[model samples]
Target: MITEAEKWTKEFYQKRGWSEYGPFIRIGFLMEEAGELARAVRAYEIGRDRPDETKRTAGELKRELVEEMGDVMGNLIMLAGMYDVSLEDMMEAHRKKLTERFKGETS
Candidate 1:
C-alpha cells in the first residue's frame, strides 16, 4: 500500500520543484530535519513547551514526539527517493545486521 507520506512526498517535491535537488542537497535537508527532531526531543524531555493538559498523557506526549519524528522521516524518505534507495530494503538489511550482532542477547 502506498502510504499517505509517500503520496504527500511526491506531490510536495513536485509542487516545490525539489526534484531538481539531488541527493547531496536532500541529504543536507535530511540532516536539518534530524536536528529539528533532536531539539524537539530535548524540549519534551525537559517538560518545556508542553500542552496545558492537567495530566500529560502518554498519547499527548507521544503525539508531539511523533510530529517531529515525522518531519525527520519525511526528509529521509525524500533523500531516499533522490537516490533510488528503498527504505524497506534498507530496514530489512539493518534488521539482519542487528540480529546478527545481538545473536546471543535477549530483551
Candidate 2:
C-alpha cells in the first residue's frame, strides 16, 4: 500500500509539475499537512461549527479528521519519496528501534 501510494503521489506530483520541488519544499508541504491534521484533531475533540451548521456532529468531525490524516500521510509519503525512502522500510526501522530501546518494557 505504501509503495502504491508513493507511485501514485510521484505521478500526481509530476502531472501537476510539482516534481521539480526539492525535499525542502516537500518538507514545507508536510508541515502544512501536519498542521491541518492537528487542527482536525482539535475539531474532532471539541467540535466546530460550519457556516451552514450550528455545530458539527461527532461523525462529521471524525470523517474530516480522517481526511486530514490522509493529507498528512500523503505529504509524508511524498517527502519520503523525495529522499528515496520507502514508508514501509521506515515503519520497519521504527518498530525495530522501539523494540530494541524498550526491550520488555512494553506489556
Candidate 3:
C-alpha cells in the first residue's frame, strides 16, 4: 500500500511546481533517481569504503539510503500524478496479484 508519507510527498512535489516537464523527461529523471537509490542500497549492504578515506558506518549509510529512497519514491509519485494514475488503486491491485501468486505468504 502507498503510505500517508507517499501521499504527502506527491503533494510536496505538486507544491514545488514540478509538473512542467513532459513524461519522457520525468521518466528519465525518475530512472536517474532510481539509480541513486540503488547505489544507496549497495552502500547499506556493504560498507561505503574508499581507499583514500574512512568508511561510513552502517547507521550513517542507512540514513543516506533512506534519503535516496525518498527521492526515488517522490519521482514515482510525481509521474503517477502527471499521468493521472492512482497509486492507491495500483498498489491495491498489485497486492491482490501478489496474494494470488503467493497464497501462503504474509504481506
Candidate 4:
C-alpha cells in the first residue's frame, strides 16, 4: 500500500519540478500540513473554536480532516523520498520496533 503511494509521490513531485525544492522545503510543508491536520482533527470532533469556522457542518469538518490527513501523508512520503528513505522500509522498521517494544499488546 505505502510502496505504491511512494512511487506515485516521487513522480508527482518530479513532474511538477517540486523535487528541486529540496528537503528543507519538504520539511516546511510537513510542518504546515501537520498543523492543518491538528486543527482539522479538533474542528471535526470537538466543534469549532473560531466564529468564522463554526458554519461548517459535521460532514464538511470530517471531509476537512480527511483532506488534511492526506496532505500530511503526502508530505511525509515526499520528505522520505528526499532522504532516500523508502516508506516500505520505514513501515517494516516501525513494525519491528513497536512489536518488540510491546510484545504482547496486540489483541
Candidate 5:
C-alpha cells in the first residue's frame, strides 16, 4: 500500500500539470512537513505539561502524532516522485543499511 502511494502521487501531480515545478513543489512540501512536525512537538509538550488533565487524553496525542506522520509521508512521496525514485527501492536500501549497522559491519 505504501509503495502504491508513490505511484498515486506521481499520477496526481501529472494530472494537475505540476510535473514542471517538481523541484520547487517538493521543497515547499518539505517545509510544510517540518511545520507539521513542529506542531506535533508543541502538542506533545502541552500534553506533557498537563499530565493530570483528564480532558487531554493519550489518544489525543496519538492523533497528533499520526497527523504529523501523514504529513511526512505525503511529502516524502512527493519528493520521491519528483526525483523519479521508487519507494520500494528506497526501503530496500534502508533495510540493507540497517542490517549492516546492526551487525556491526559499518558505522
Candidate 6:
C-alpha cells in the first residue's frame, strides 16, 4: 500500500513538473531533514533534563518527537521520489553496505 509519505512526495514532484535536478540537491534536502531530527532529539533531551522542569511532560516530548520524525520521514520520502528510489530498496542496500563494513573479514 502507498503510504502518506509516498502520496506527499508524489504531489511534491508532480506540482513541480518533475524537473530533473542534480543529486546534490537531494543530498542537501536530506541534510535539512537530518537537522530537523537532531533538533527534535535535542528538544527531548532538554525537556527531560530539568532540575525543576515540570512544565513539559514526557507525553509532550513524545508528541514533539513524533512530529519531528514525521518531518524527517516526509523529507526522506520526497528525496527518494526525486531520485526514483524505493525506501525498501534503499534500506536493503543500506543493510548490505553496513553488513559488509562490519562483518566482512577482509581489511
Every model's TM-score: 0.73, 0.84, 0.76, 0.84, 0.63, 0.65
Weakest ten-residue segment in model 1 by summed lDDT: 47-56
Residue-wise C-alpha lDDT for candidate 5, range 1-107, written one tens digit per residue = 35666677667767987555666777797788888788777777664455574555668877878888877776777777666667787888899998977996566
lDDT of 3: 0.80
Q: Tell me the tens digit of each residue's lDDT in model 6 across 34-95.
A: 88778768868764455775667678877878987876676677677666777777888998
Q: How close is candidate 6 to the true structure, as a TM-score?
A: 0.65
Clashes counted in candidate 1 amount to 0
Candidate 5 RMSD computed on C-alpha atoms after optimal superposition onto the true structure: 4.7
**Model 4 weakest 10-residue run by lDDT:** 46-55
Model 4: per-residue lDDT, tens digit, 28-98? Answer: 98999999999889877876677664478888988999999988888888888766778787888899998
| C-alpha lDDT score of every prediction, in listed order | 0.75, 0.82, 0.80, 0.84, 0.73, 0.71
- Comparing 1 with 3 on lDDT, the higher-scoring candidate is 3
Mind giving the per-residue lDDT tens digits that candidate 3 earns over 1-107? 65687679766766887767778988998999999988889878875566986788778888989989888877887787776666797688898998899998676
Best by lDDT: 4
User: Hey, what RMSD does candidate 6 come out at?
Assistant: 4.9
- Better structure of 4 and 6 per lDDT: 4
Off by over 4 Å in 5: 12-20, 45-56, 105-107
Candidate 3, residue 31: lDDT: 95
Question: lDDT per residue, candidate 2, 24-105, as tens digits?
Answer: 8878888998888898898888655558656777898899899988888877877777677799888988999999999979
Per-candidate count of clashing residue pairs (backbone under 3 Å): 0, 0, 0, 0, 0, 0
* Stronger candidate by lDDT (2 vs 6): 2
Superposed by TM-score, candidate 2 places the C-alpha of residue 102 at a distance from the truth, in angstroms, of: 0.2
